[model samples]
Target: MKVVKIGGSVFKKENIINLAEFIVKNYEPYKTIIVVSALGRSPYPYSTDELINLFVEFKQNHSNGNNYLLDLSKSFVVSCGENIAAGLLSFAINYLNPEFKAIPLNAFQANIITTDNPIDSDIITIEIDNILRLLENKFTPVICGFQGVSKSGKLTILKRGGTDITAAFITKLMKANEIHIIKDVDGLKSAPPNIIPHCITIEKCNIDELAEATMNGNPVVNPEAINILQETNAKIIIKSIFSEKFTLSSKEIVPTQLVSNISNKDNITKFVIYLPSQMKNKTLVLDKVLKEIFENSISLDFINLDVFNNLASFIVNNNQVEKIKQILDNNQLHYKTMGRLSKVSIIGYNMRGKPGIMYRINKALLNEKISIIQAQDSHISISLLVPLKYLATTIKALHQEFFEDY
Candidate 1:
């Protein structure tokens, strides 16, 4: 059996018939399951983004102010996209060829159980019996991606862009041969093509390489999908529905680049939480400050909690720095901001257990006279916090150092 996940990029009324034709032509004789994302970003009524906007407009107009109800209704409202996509694709497939018994299935009907979180929920369990029955009856079961039902029957959507995880889970649970992730782009690239004029499309890479390239704030594939299939052996093929050119993601074939990809984002701001030595329970105060930050919906990254030094720091989107400042000032907390920062990131499986990777990164930036304000590294990636003015030069330097041949 094969699991094909059609992303929102190509899951639309304009392309549904063509995709249906392709599905019927290729997998007519096999027990195939399809996971579909909402329609691509358009003015279309049922795209998840549009539906989310609709929900926002409703909230703004009505002023319901009920967090629980708004959350529940928002999830229910957004999930309608996948529901429509599944049904439309299933019908198109059947309409294209009568022999293909394509049947649309919702999360609840397909027995996909998830947590109660309306906006971002985890899949708890999935019973394959219903899907098995449908396939045994020679029906092509098309499931709405990115959503499942809680035990209480509340419709729960996974994290934003979670349709990929839905497909990965299906591939693992059904023990399918492989996963075909159909997207608009041909395949993964060494760098954002627009940024790096000479970048090349990566032909094939290990799952880790693919994850690194995709996870660095790129919207190619949901990182959660890679995490779900960590133990899975299924070959992952990412291809554009419009062309046969693809990137084969396996466990063994790591990327050839020492640093596989360069990722950067603009308008990031650094924040520091100062814990005064005289303050009793400095740790507790830090915790309270962090709690208030989260409560105010201030998301952050690159958190450096220096308990010994009685200080804590992190980065947040620049737009949120004002709000963060207000929260800190209102709580009478001591903090400071390093605004107008940018993040430059690089990742490679080759860097695993290898020394001097940081030296190379530092040397590259140092040669270019770019000051790295702060830096962090894990087994797979190295991230740098640099001034926004040096962002372009930093990327050029890193690319020249790490990917000069390209």
Candidate 2:
């Protein structure tokens, strides 16, 4: 079985017909499942965003200011977009190919069970047997993406851009051979095309790199989709739906048992908070500090809390140190600061039991005369803090040593 998720950007009528024809021509030999998003942006009244906005306006004008009712109404209203898309696409596919039976399925019809959040529900389970029965009967299932049924039988929607999550979950549940996410772009690029003049399309990437890229603001796919892919054996392919020369040779995310990628994080400041041994109410003080950190919108890059030793160390961007210090001083806590550091990491899932990997990294940096201030390693990554001036050199040496081929 193969799962293909058609994105909202290509949700035009002509595009839907084209997609239907394309599926019949290309996927005739396999059991195929199609998932479709709501229609494309503006000019399409049934687009997800437009539908949500329409609900918001209606609630403001007519609702009694009840939060729960508003949320429920929003879910019901927003889900109509996907329902329409599924119905239209199913009809198109059936019209284009009478021999192949195509049927539209909503969250309730498809038996997609999710949390009762109404607006941003997470899938709890899906009725795999029902879908299998449809396949057994030679019925092509056109599932409405981004919608689900709550345990209480209420309509719910996954958050925005959730069609990817739907596709990923269905692929995993069906144990499909692969998942293809049809988009408007050619494929994933090394960097944003407009930002990097020479950015090239990456034909292949692993889940770790794709997740990292997504976190660093690369718009490839949903991060939740990548998270799901990480736990499953399913491969994800990104392709262009608009290209006439579209082929299966687009960007692919295959399973990599272990892979490494380089990450450069600059403008870091490390803090060491010293406390008396057996300090009373340590938890309370720590909670207060954490509350202040969050209230100020400071993001911690690294943190280590040693309650037994009466020490707490954390790393944040240099710009946030002054505000953090003010909070600590106001609370009469003693701390020291190491200002202006950069964190470079070799991120991989295979570094845990791999002997000498850390040694090679340390040796390479030493050879470059780059002193490491602090080093931290998890099963997934090895991170080092160095002087800001040495960051570029450290990244170069490490990238050359570990990820040259990548």
Report the Cα lDDT for residue 368, model 2: 100
Report the poorest 10 consecutive residues by lDDT, candidate 2: 244-253
Angstrom error at residue 17, model 2: 2.4
lDDT of each: 0.83, 0.77
- Candidate 1: residue 226 Cα off by (Å): 1.6
Residue-wise lDDT of candidate 2 within 1-406, one digit each (tens)? Answer: 8898989887876577887877777675228888889988766888887988898788779888779778888898888889888998888878888766888889888899999888888988788787899889888888999999899999989977788888889988998877888887766654344433343455566666667655433556787887886777766777775554321221243424344346556788999999877679997999998998899878886688998889999898777888999999998898999987877767655565878988898899999998888888766677788998887677677756764455
Which TM-score value belongs to model 1? 0.87
Write down the worst ten-residue block by lDDT for model 1.
Answer: 211-220
Q: For candidate 2, what is the lDDT?
A: 0.77
Which residue pairs in candidate 2 collide?
A: none
Top lDDT model: 1
- lDDT measured at residue 333 in model 1 versus the true structure, 0 to 100: 77
**How many residue pairs clash in each candidate at the backbone level?**
0, 0
